[model samples]
Target chain A: MLKYQQIASDIERYIEENALQQGDKLPVLEALMARFEVSKSTITKSLDLLEKKGVVYQVRGSGIFVRRHKRKGYISLLSNQGFKKDLEGFQITSKIIEFDVRKPTQEAADNLNISQEEDVYYVKRVRYINGQTLCLEESYYSKSIITFLNKEIVSESIFDYIREGLGLNVGFSDIYLQAGRLNEEEAGYLGLEKGFPKFYVETLFHLTNGQPFDFSKVTYNFEQSQFFIQANGPL
Target chain B: MLKYQQIASDIERYIEENALQQGDKLPVLEALMARFEVSKSTITKSLDLLEKKGVVYQVRGSGIFVRRHKRKGYISLLSNQGFKKDLEGFQITSKIIEFDVRKPTQEAADNLNISQEEDVYYVKRVRYINGQTLCLEESYYSKSIITFLNKEIVSESIFDYIREGLGLNVGFSDIYLQAGRLNEEEAGYLGLEKGFPKFYVETLFHLTNGQPFDFSKVTYNFEQSQFFIQANGPL
Candidate 1:
């Protein structure tokens, strides 16, 4: 890692371990330079990268503070081609079962916060981690974003394209979870018997501007996967 | 509604409208008594109810305070009838397609945080809501808890009986959501053509004392149902 990257991680660790709540200023540039034994320019570059990555923010005369919220949400681009970074132990296998551009259904329209007849892109893929079938994801994107997609892009993480290439940053999502039975086609694809129980989730992601960016439905096979959500209640 | 209930609603409305955050103390009893035009006894009674309901809490020598967290989690009763409370809104037509008490498999043992071969109650139910198939729920419960359960209790909202009568609460849960295709048995239960997509969620609830309580797999028919989760990420 670069010297500046090490500084960034050091600062991140300190923030995680201490009382550096949102809006708290960090040590001055001279302080960081002395502490890390790095050049003043190196410290400046590190803080700049952190700001660009949304890890921190700069206040012209006030100095820097940690971003109020860290990487709290994600816009996942589930695909067969290993995305930008793969989960260490998980191997992802994706099969594009369907891809089409069609007028949004009422449900899709409501999710995207658009008119019902507007065009949307529907893409479906099945993912396997390790050797076990894990999940199936069906993504719905507004037609305005369809221009950014192509068949070749489908093979990689669509999220990478949307972010690095298209400059669309996905923020938090409203998610729901429930249980239901699988239909026949899904059963065959997931290698399970018909009438088996499955897990389901629906998600709506919004951009930083609070506009709907993507909607998706996902299902997971029984016995092979688990979920973890941190509960931060009313407070 | 009772006069006290109205007073409670008024307080709740005031809190919301004024954007009062947790830890903010309520106005003094005399002030509330005058403002709401209710008897001192009535206002005190309303506050008492809110405290018991886990909506608010009081500290000795200190005034009342809003609860920082809503203690609204699950309670799994041993009885089948206790399942109705949380499982409401679904015109539930349930068939216990598979039910057993057996040694925990490796995966089950790991999820339940129990030793291999530990006894567990495995139950699978296919639920139909509104005359349409809705979801399938598969659950695993530790034998210690299920020993208190019976066929009659399994048919209802198990959460209610455990909470109301036994005082056992399923406190915090670490939930995860993903997407996947239905396997054959699940597909048949929901009456879907093969490869049809659905939503999937896997949940693990932990007891207040930090013991693993239950692991559940839920699947929902995409055309009919959606799961909802509200998140305010680590603030």
Candidate 2:
């Protein structure tokens, strides 16, 4: 992250920690500069970003004030963080419905940039937030990249396991978000009626080296799920 | 956009224009550098981005080869642009269902940061792509900001009108993406089953000066709408 963005995040944390209300005044620029050990220009840039994100606003000749009391968002569309990390302060758990190594399907092979002869870890999992099922995900991980996996690892964050356990850098993903309806099997798992409309996310994960590592399809619970995004700058 | 990103977009457009296929080789670094009037470093960064996006691959000794041929995406979630601008090639048309001036509702007032007494331009529109209905929308724009509106303007790009005719700089928006079921009235206009599931987008638009201007709710066809996003960098 850039220096200004880091400072902006720190300021957001400070606001949350202090329970700042809307229109609540923040410390002077000089104090913020001292606190963050940054220059005046950097502080100004950070404040500018905060203002742009609708978190805080600056009053001329006055001081920075909280435009919003809380940082309200569920998922940031630009962030690559998994649900465990993305939805912070939430108790997230997963159930491994099926886990096995198998031959890559044609679609999986094409998406992962691997041949059909290659083996892929075919995993079906259900993710729950606070013990309520939120999504059903089916993923195919290339055995070339992720060499080994077990039932235990599949129950937790596979991305974390890929990063920490295997030391492979999880780079970015191309995600396709579509509107979808639940089938009988999906409806049963998500406790929704058949033909209920919801969100579907298809993601292609890549390594930092630009090699495709995994592909996943996820269906989210309709009523309990909402995705939040923010965009700024001139039109 | 940054220099590297601009070059990346140009390269993508070139590939599209020329109909480059997968495994086709692009111009060499020196050739691209000369073509784009940039240096080797910039070309390398551009190519690296393309590689990460699964657009190309670099061979050790030969050249940069196409990893995938197409620039495939429907909508970028982070973009502040409207649907007309975002979907560049498609023919988009809007039918103005209802247009009038009204007192702001409490939710509308809160989202637009306007008072209940404030007058708002209430617009209802059904959008079609290539003559097929896609979405039904309802919007409330602050009269203080918009100043004026008409059925003709409502039938076209309202965002364009706000920018060009009104000479106002639109800043950005915070969007909420949710799963929704259509009501009888909405389904009637959308030509969908009354309880059919679909996608709902709630948007709060702000001006460059940190003032809220418009609040909108849009419902999209489940079968037709898809949103694409990408996130790069480590983990």
DockQ of every predicted complex: 0.14, 0.48
lDDT of 1 at A192: 88
10 residues in a row with least lDDT, candidate 2 chain A: A69-78
| lDDT per residue (tens digit) for residues A1-235 in model 1 | 6788888878877877885755577888889889889998999988966654445666556677664322222222221123223254456667788888877778878777789777888888888776677778888898775455766677677876877778864544556565567789778878888767677667676553345667888777865654444331111
Alpha-carbon runs more than 4 Å astray in model 1: A1-173, A176-228, A232-235, B1-90, B193-195
Compare the candidates by lDDT and give the number of the best one. Answer: 2
Q: Where is model 2 more than 4 Å wrong at Cα?
A: A1-9, A20-31, A39-73, A85-89, B1-12, B20-73, B85-89
Q: Cα deviation in Å at residue B185, candidate 1?
A: 2.8
Docking class of 2: acceptable
- Prediction 1 global C-alpha lDDT: 0.64
Interface RMSD of each: 12.9, 5.1
Looking at model 2, residue A83 earns an lDDT score of 69
TM-score of chain A of each: 0.66, 0.77
lDDT of 2: 0.80
